[model samples]
Target: MRYSKATDYALHTMMFLAAATPRTTIGVQQLAERQHVSPTYLSKILTKLVKAGMIESTTGVNGGYRLKRDWENISFLDIIHAIEGSASLFDCSLDHGPECLIQRVVTAAEEKMETYLREQKLADLAKELNLMH
Candidate 1:
């Protein structure tokens, strides 16, 4: 399955947060502008993140949202799970609906892909993105 724009926006937003000062709140408006995403949609994405305990939000002057935990500890799979839920590609067996012989091959391939993604940490992505030198 393809990733939704929500996931892209979430990862971009999280990368910025990871690079920013810790414990410092970042306004949604500014974050949206920086990430080149609409504030309305970004707000929804941020809400999901906050609910997942990945971020903390505060209202009032000099307040916005901040990461609840260290970026190094956050994984790409964690973000994917938070936004997309525990969804899987090969959720069904081909043989369950039809007499297909590709079920095992499809399942094995899907598992390998999932494992690779699960091993990829958000920190790894951030480092890749920050590579300018």
Candidate 2:
């Protein structure tokens, strides 16, 4: 299973925010430059994050974006869900068929991955990356 490009950007963006000073707001253009992503694309991702309640945004001269919750409160799964809606790695579309062996295996793997991601917080990831002080 693979995550979408938007999911990758969301994860990176969240990590960047987590590494920044608490309550610090960053402009999309600046963040895009630092992350080597297009501002237009990043802006769309940021909007999804805001709508998901994962990040907050403002307008005007001092306007920018900031994490809505502490990094410790955010998880990889949270970011995944915010961007991809669901973290299920399997598309199990065989509801009518008799039991599919592959479906069982995929479901188990998806569950395991979901558990792992839920246990991993953004703060812990930042610390591992040495982005936390």
The sequence of per-residue lDDT tens digits that candidate 1 reaches over residues 41-88 is 899999999988888999998778888866577777788778988755
Q: lDDT tens string, model 2, 72-113? A: 788899999989988456666766433778887778778888
TM per candidate: 0.81, 0.87
- The model with the greatest lDDT is 2
Top TM-score prediction, candidate number: 2
lDDT of 2 at 42: 94
- What are the per-model C-alpha RMSD values against the true structure? 2.7, 2.2
Error of 1 at 112 (Å): 2.0
